[model samples]
Target chain A: MRNRLKELRAERGWSQQDLAERLEVSRQSVNAIETGKYDPSLPLAFRIAEVFAMRIEEIFLKG
Target chain B: MAAYNLAFRRYIRRFVPLTIAYGASVALATAVIPDGAPASPGIIAIAVLPGLAVVGWLWAMARLLVELDDEYLRMLEVRKFLVATGTTLALTSIWGILELFTPAMPKLPVFFVFPLWCLGLAVGAVFNRLRFGAARCA
Candidate 1:
């Protein structure tokens, strides 16, 4: 999976840790998602989308 | 959700050290042979009890992680489970091969098997953590 998490987080002036805190995940998990090393499950993808107030498609794309 | 995660982390910090201590004691007993030769009757129970306790603690820890409102916990757990299962199967096969080649080899007791199981588990956990980048497996 690919995501614009880093860009979105940066636009909001949020560090990876800050995004992780908001998403209720570890900073490492956030990093993994941002770097495309790991893909979040559907519920977690929804949580991430919820945090950014965007549709999941906007944040993540099939890869 | 964040606070709940922090709370669970706190609980784990409190539990892990004691669990490791008990585990280490069991491992140490398995590593050393009784000075005069024969394995003692209590050795198997010694290994099995502490090993079972560690497994129980891990199950509880996984439950606590699940309660903390992160679905990724389940993914991390499933990954860890797969790794451990694969490794256990591999090691058991190797042990069986070794037994076939050396039929007179001293039988490993249940106690020795417990620590060996833990060692395999730890190796599997490390593999999962490295591959998945999550400490939850540990």
Candidate 2:
């Protein structure tokens, strides 16, 4: 799975740590998702979507 | 300004005292057992205490997996255990075969296996940090 997390986070003018703080996760988690090293679970995907004020499909795509 | 994780904090609080107790139990057992009367029930009770603590540690780890709430942290933990498990099993198999073939090799005590697994956890921590940039596993 690939995600637009970095782009979305960049758009918000927030660092990975800032996004992690908003999602209540470690900065490494955000970084992993951004770098395509890890995929988020459904609950976490939903949380990420909610954080960015976008739908999950808009943020993540199957690759 | 991300604060320290509260769950990890609580885990440390719970583990430290248990770890201390485990050390104390082993110390007392070692102090008492070298006198050629190591088979008595009192010595046995003291020695058994640390194993019980080991079991508790296993239980605590499982509980941590359930209660951590952070998905990425959970994934990191699961990956670590997988790495540890594979490493330990490989080591044990190799050592067992080596011991069978070599007369110079001393037999390891069965009780040492848990501590060996813990060492695997340490190795896994290193793997996690190197591969995923977690910095620390424990």
lDDT of each: 0.71, 0.83
* Top candidate when judged by TM-score against the true structure: 2
Which stretches of candidate 2 lie above 4 Å from their native place? Answer: B1-4, B35-38
Instruction: State the lDDT of candidate 1 residue by residue for B13-43, as single tens digits.
Output: 7568758767676667657546565556676
Show the lowest summed lDDT stretch of 10 residues, model 1 chain B.
B106-115
Considering the two chains of model 2, state its CAPRI-style docking category.
Answer: medium
- Model 1 compared with the native: what TM-score? 0.70
- Tens-place lDDT per residue, model 2, B1-138, is 233376667667778887887888888887878867847888788878998888777777777777777778877788888888898889888888889999888887777787788889888889988888777475
Q: How large a fraction of the reference contact set does each model reproduce? A: 0.31, 0.56
Residue A34, candidate 1: how far off, in angstroms? Answer: 0.8
Reference-based TM-score of each model: 0.70, 0.90
Give residue A20's error in model 1 in angstroms.
Answer: 1.4
